[model samples]
Target: MARHEDRDPLNEEDLAQIADLPKVELHLHHEGAAPPAFIRGLAKEKSVNLSGVFREDGSYAYRDFVHFLSVYEAATQVLQTPRDYARLTTALLEECAANGVIYCETFLSPDFCGGGDLGAWREYLHAIREAADAAERDLGVTLRGVVTCIRHFGPEKSRPAARCAAETAGDWIVGFGMGGDENRGELNQFLYAFDMAREAGLKLTTHAGEWRGPSEVRSAVEDLRVARIGHGVRAIEDLALVDLLAETGVVLEVCPGSNVTLGVYPNLAKHPIAELRDRGVKVTVSTDDPPFFHTNMRREYFNLANAFQWDADVLRELTRNAADAAFCDDDTREKILKRLET
Candidate 1:
């Protein structure tokens, strides 16, 4: 391996130690999370123009934040129907199982599932639920979903997205969230959408503090009533916000590699996950878009261990933390905990 720069955060031996540990992933995106080979083949079958999305080696060619969106859309085009989503869900779970993921909560978009029609969204949801069931039975990995609206499309679109989420809230689709192009927008703009999901008894979480700063996390908690905040590490920059998150017991799903790869943090050592944890924040690990970020659950565990010198006990706490923060009911949570114990 080539010697890293002066800022190298981890040595090679550090990475090898944590690769075999079991883990739970809570912040992954469905489209952006696909394994590169799986996505490439899907595009090939559909003859989709994915040239700009992936290089010849099957790695995503993301230039920056803007180009990442275009590439994500291109990959998403192949998943046009229920079966496509079903297959994608199953495939993701299989990869997760191989990487020792016991449970995962994926973000699903109603925008792609016919853009808010309750009737069509049900079909799309059924496929995802069925795929989750199959993956659980076949691979012993449990999966759930969080229905989300593409925030860039404006909150007007979220009413339908929220409606679909409300009508279909159940065993697998246990939560609601928002993803896509939402770095600068205010959380109150989408309050109605969160209100609908809340009334449906669905748990809520939202992306915040990734591109923005600590104030973004405050807005999400204040307006959206989120139980968790995705990439909320920037809260570390603001003492009051950090205290609020810790006092209120809000979980932070921090993605170390994703933050580093996307320039959210200068480097892994500069990442605040460890600092947040030291300050009593409930933090867990995940890969937001595994293939796009060149990450997987095993790799995330390894990277975190390398960065923080976490041992097996710390990794186990991470999984238990995910279970506690999961939207599943008591029965499902028990089942997952049993697996984690063994």
Candidate 2:
């Protein structure tokens, strides 16, 4: 086994070299990662009530993990029109493209798209997808959508979210999952939603092993049958679970920076990514909410290189993991992997 890896916690120059490697982000949230300046501008333009969502630096300010969600939603409330989402998507893809992201799958909640309704969801999805097309033309990054239900809102609301997902399943919206306050309920509560997406030919993924425990991961695997897991860092708690993940060939969308930022682990040193990788578990790196977590793909690579001593090869392999797990059709995935070869 390759024990002496390259992405350690000090190789800034090496980190710089790998920072430009083509990347595939599998866990970013559409609403949670808006630039603070963008949100503040929208709030002011609309005369909305957003008093203290920002720092004196005009960046986002949040007290804790839960508070982070409130600030995320507060920032989202100002985006009242399809144009807002379209512009946001355009700008976000530009930033992501700058960071060498060639392929991205971001979480899009119907509640935010249309507040749990079908017609409104279609309008919002169409506008944002148009922006995706424009962004692709300009930035050379393909953006795929994942319709996820906020789990904390309970299972009933998830039904409509899944319905919207089923209605929207096509070339752009290719997957579905769940991401919300982790303590909301058991994985079984959202099984129907996942099943719905899966039956609609959508690939599946779910946020597990974050605030919850390995039991949650177990439940997610057992009940949701997800193809990939979001965060999934907490699965380290059960050694058997780790082996099971490895054997099952399930991918873990690991976001080290997000975990540290949310206080899931004290720092990257304590992160379970290296261990999971060494154990043959396929773990890919991503920035779950880049700006909100004060990170980007470039910074995430730098941090991982510093923490895990990852070299360009390792970063390349991580990109492969993401590409392999991506919901893009096989032809697109092949194209992405070919581009990453450079």
- Candidate topping TM-score: 2
Model 2, 168-283: lDDT tens digits are 99889999999989988888977788888999999999999999999999888888888899988899999999999999989999999999988999999999998999999999
Count of steric clashes across candidates, in order: 0, 13
Model 2's number of clashes is: 13
Alpha-carbon local distance difference test for all models: 0.83, 0.88
Query: Each model's RMSD to truth, in Å?
Result: 4.2, 1.6
Local distance difference test, candidate 2:
0.88
Task: Tell me each candidate's TM-score.
Answer: 0.93, 0.97
Cα lDDT tens digits for candidate 1, 212-271 = 888889998888889998889889989888888899999998899999998988888889
TM-score of 1: 0.93
What would the C-alpha RMSD of candidate 2 be, to one decimal place? Answer: 1.6
- Candidate 1: regions farther than 4 A off: 1-17
Best by the lDDT measure: 2
